[model samples]
Target: MTYDLVVIGAGPAGMSAAIKAAKAGAHVAIIDENPVSGGKLLGQLYHEPDSGWWVGRNIAREMIAKASSLGVAIFRKMEIWGIFPKWNIMLNNGERLTTEHVLIATGAAEKAIPVEGWTKPGVMAIGAAQTLTNFHRVKPGKKVVIIGVDPLSLSVAQELKMAGVEVAGIYPPPATEVSSDKSNPKQIIQGLSAMAHLAPNALLKAAGKAANHPTIKNIAAKCYPSFGVKVWGIPLHLRKTITAIEGEKQVEQVRITAIDGNGNQKNGRTKTMGVDCVCISGGLYPLSELAEAAGCDFVYIEELGGHVPLHSPELETTKDGIYVAGNITGIEGAKVAMAQGELAGTAISSRLGLLQKGSDAISEAQVKVQDARANAVITFQQHIESGREKLAQCWHTNVQTSSGKG
Candidate 1:
């Protein structure tokens, strides 16, 4: 049976859009690759106490229940491999879905820093580490070194500490200013302060002592100016780059050397650190491949990562009858994602005649969604600009090797 709307993700955005459309009397289907329905939100580490953004979880869960009540079909463990021009989706599990309307909300992927030995078994991204501790209840390692200084990295460190794992220290990559454009300075500062309060210096020092054991002497605390006051007492080191990773069965030691701003290694200035796990957090990238393939027009905005497709206030992409929402559009917290999802849902309902067009209710809802989207854009722009130089450097090297070949 052809569906009125087929959403290509079960995360907050897809779920929200599907529920709204289904409740409006449309035949709806939601598809996801994971065994369970919830996306990264469910698997994320719960380090900070109830931040407002986390409300998306409950909202998404409610939408799922509502959709089920409305007879909406939810398909789990079904991966969509391709999308045709006519909006026909090919699922890996031998199912083909055709829908009159399509919404892409596949979400974003975590980016990894290209450092020597980063591909080794002990090296993992911050997101991977969160999946281990939060979802599987498994600690990534007894002694761990985190390589970023954002709220996400800080949250990972706190969660690791709570799980009885020793965080050797947080090694921020470099000193970069927080972007004023993309951040709600007041709220971000408050969150950072609270994260700092959770793990005081005394606590980090104790963990350092435990990690400094002869067997684990490779662990050390190094600081970069970019990490700010939140990450104090970790041994401070600068202008260093990883040279090589050494170990037989598992990660045992890493060789690093000082380097100038020009990416040149300093002569005879090298150091080694012993550690079992290296968690890197470069940042996130927009997973807009499906959106792009669906004929959405993209513009390279420096503050929004790269190649963010232009979309209407309702999250509708340039392609008529197609929409984009959530992290697939840009990187923002879960709260902003939920707001976008709701807005898209309402717009779809109006377009399909399920809801009256341009009514007072729809107008009010649109305003709220637009405001949230505006704020999120500003915050995300700041983050992208803050790391623009490093990101550009990495992108240049990546392009030289990948050659625009996916």
Candidate 2:
């Protein structure tokens, strides 16, 4: 089959981009490996403290409906293995599809920090547990201990509780004793600072506004210590770490240890908690293997989930005709992904000559995308704003050098 644009991964990003491009008169098709197209979105059921109930279900429904109404073809259960130049894509089902342009919204894969007994049954990623509970109607376990203190892990803990799973506690991953040269102290500070948002809105605002005053900032900082927020009547243990998961046929108990401020174990003090399941969440990283296969330039921006495709602000990768958006661009949330999808879609439509350059529609789309990004609820990772500036600068430099700017 041939199309003007073939989008891989029918998640928020792919669907948004497809809908935008289709509205601009491009024949678009979206393919995903799952039988359904929602991607991780199908599993996300969390509440935003400010926005009341924030459910991915509503967003996914809207995106799918819009795409369908726009006549954008949706193909599921198709795994793409090869992407040759000139937009030839090979599917695992022995079929091939060609397109004038491609957008990879492959999104991200959950990162698992390996601990002993991780391979045992009943041990899974937080995202997996969420899928089983939210989408499949299967409770992951009767009781659970979650290992991670990020928003995703915390939110999943509450979701699991609502789904009838008894959550023991949420803890941070075992801290590394050895520090690498690549480690950025500022990033650690930034992450810790952002943790204040987990508190009530008033506290978050106080911390942000008081940052300039060292005395006030110190007081504000003191207000937030690890695991400061309780969700669904569950405690998030910030000063604790999971040493191991113990089980025979399935998960039984987890060894928890207390750590000092430096992440070093404190006097070998250990505690054991009995649980039917253990959820490990090291974090999230972009699933950029396909983009790598496409020969896009990659740069290691730790802030944007390790090595991401180096692309222009327009969302075009170093390789022509291939664009990216969503978590694959960085470790952001569904809303950001939707905004990015809109942007990439508009850019692709303009590039395909379906939309005139400098047209009102294109300008409007760009403005809307910018608004969406600015107002996003979750913008994790560090240096995202400056990192984007760096991308633009590098892209401009490359273009000027190619054109003999010197």
RMSD of each: 10.2, 3.5
| Candidate 2 local lDDT, 1-406, one digit each (tens) | 9999999999988888999999999999999999877898888876566677766767788888989999998888989999998889999989889997899999999877777788889899999999999988899999898876565776688789888899888776776542211122222223434445554345334544565466665444344465544556786564567888998787889998876544455777887888989998767899999999999988877767778888877788988899999888888778778778888899888888888663566567667766765665555654566666666677787778867945
lDDT of 1 by residue, 17-83 (tens): 7877787777888888887676766655442333432333455567678878999899988878788
Top candidate by lDDT: 2
Q: Which ten residues in a row have the lowest lDDT in candidate 2?
A: 178-187
Score every model by TM-score.
0.74, 0.88
Candidate 1 minimal-lDDT segment of 10 residues:
179-188
Q: Report lDDT per candidate.
A: 0.64, 0.77
How many residue pairs clash per model?
Answer: 5, 0
